[model samples]
Target: MQKKSIQNKDSLKRFVDKGINEKELSPFDPPDAYNPLNIETIPYEKMHPFLKELIDEHKNFAEVLSKFETALMNWKNNNWIFNDEIDIGLKQFFNFFDEKVPLHNQKEEKKLFPLLHKKLIEIGEHNSVDSSITGINLMEDEHLKVAQAVAIVFNFLELGSQLPDKRSREITFELAYEQGMAIIETMKLHIFREENILFPQAMKLLSKEKLDDFN
Candidate 1:
């Protein structure tokens, strides 16, 4: 039996490698064997998988935000000077975080939050909804604050690119660092709240029916 298990393990490893060394394999490789969902027939048992995917996407957003913070910090500690290409890339990052992210928040605030609230209420758990409401409101407020900070970064980049004279290099870099710190702090708090409180409470409160509806 142990010999069979060893053979099975070897077979699985070779299947994963397919030819390339493990070090050469990309993260997205061995791509999820596509079992294209028959969405129409999905049962409640499968709803957890769907919600997990949604949560994973939000986690990916947090990672992207962290990367932006790291880049901003590197810029600040050095100098405000940026090549045209780097400036363009930073501007694009701001655009994405500022404009696109809020759309995601809206989906949470409008659709996901209300659904979760209703489920908890039905389960005779008013406290869960109350807590979620508080977190949701706080999260929204922080989102707006972060958006404003991102605008500051955008304006700084734009003005610096055009005139290159309104502020000293140190002053410009300081603004970038300050605004970037504000954005990062807000996001870290928001992510912490959502991950630690909101999401887990939501999964606990939501029934099979509710989960299926969300899906």
Candidate 2:
């Protein structure tokens, strides 16, 4: 049995290597394969997977924001230098908002936020959650505001290429830099509230049945 297990592991490792090391690794999925809904089908002894995914995405956004800021700094240092490299970097930042942020927000609004609200209500602490900041409605409102802010930044970056003069391009980039920083700062505080206050309370209050229902 031990030998068979070892052989199986070796085979799995070989498969992963071939998939990754080869040029055809276009649509790869991880072996441990996390889907938050899987938590419903399994035992709830350690249901940190989904929550961790959400938090990890927040960390990823932080990294993207950092890159955006760095790219802006480079452009500024280069005497209002606008180049293909800087454009690519700024486009990546815009794409992060376009493609990733919405999906991340969906997971929270559709899954985690609802679960948090349910738990708060069940534990008779619904009133304790600040309706202005941390409540589902308030959080959703903030999401909308953030989305609008992101759109403004996206347009600024997008229009930069079409602007006729270098001066116009530089001004647009500067505006984008400020807007992107503000949005990232707001999101950081929002994430802090969720991680420190909301997630802990939900973990304490959430029941096995609720976990099952999430699946």
Candidate 3:
């Protein structure tokens, strides 16, 4: 078992050194239909209070993601050497994801999504074949994917750091980098979808009273 594990790790290292092909990376690319549903840009002051808070959270998250990306790039370029700046960036990234993401998701899933689902169904915007198939479902699915990607990145990095061999450590770090990119890309798109499509639709479909409940 140990020999097989080492062999598999070495193979992965070779694959990473060669670089992932465009085809393998395509799945991580944003889809063609990733545009916002709303054409009009809603001003911050005009946005619902609930939405404003969520958007604020997104802005902060985006900043952290940008820093995290830079840290990842620096780490990779420096041959996976850890530094104080890189260490802080990684810590912030994981900390924000662990502390903030779940509560933010809960605000959507528990507060907003159920109401949006009902409104979407009433307005015939939901999938006809399956009422459960809606934009909300997609958002929820992406939430799970984000969590999974973060977990993979965290686990791979932690495991890689403990590995005795340089090759194994490098391979695992490379894998973590890939997963980290997934988290960043997926999150940007997810936020875009919510801001443009989901939130706008909620504002339009749901009543003022219903929306106020979010506040």
Worst ten in a row by lDDT for model 2 = 7-16
Order of all candidates by lDDT, from best down to worst?
Answer: 3, 2, 1
Better of 1 and 2 by lDDT: 2
| Candidate 1 lDDT score at position 140 | 58
lDDT of 2 at 140: 73
Best by lDDT: 3
Worst 10 residues of 3 by lDDT: 10-19
Q: State every prediction's TM-score relative to the real structure.
A: 0.62, 0.64, 0.82
The lDDT for every candidate, in the order shown, is 0.54, 0.60, 0.74
Residue 214 Cα positional deviation in candidate 1, in Å, after optimal superposition: 2.1
**What shift in Å separates residue 125 of candidate 1 from its native position after superposition?**
8.9
> Cα deviation in Å at residue 70, candidate 1?
2.4
* Candidate 1 residue-wise lDDT, 63-160, digit = tens: 77766766776665446656554455466567678666877777676656777656644644333324333334444566676777788877766655
Q: Whose TM-score is greatest here?
A: 3
Write the residue-wise lDDT of candidate 2 on 110-214 in tens digits: 877876766545544332323222245546766887899788877887797689898989888778777776676656656654565555555666765664555
Residue pairs whose backbone atoms clash in candidate 1:
none
Best of the two (2, 3) by TM-score? 3
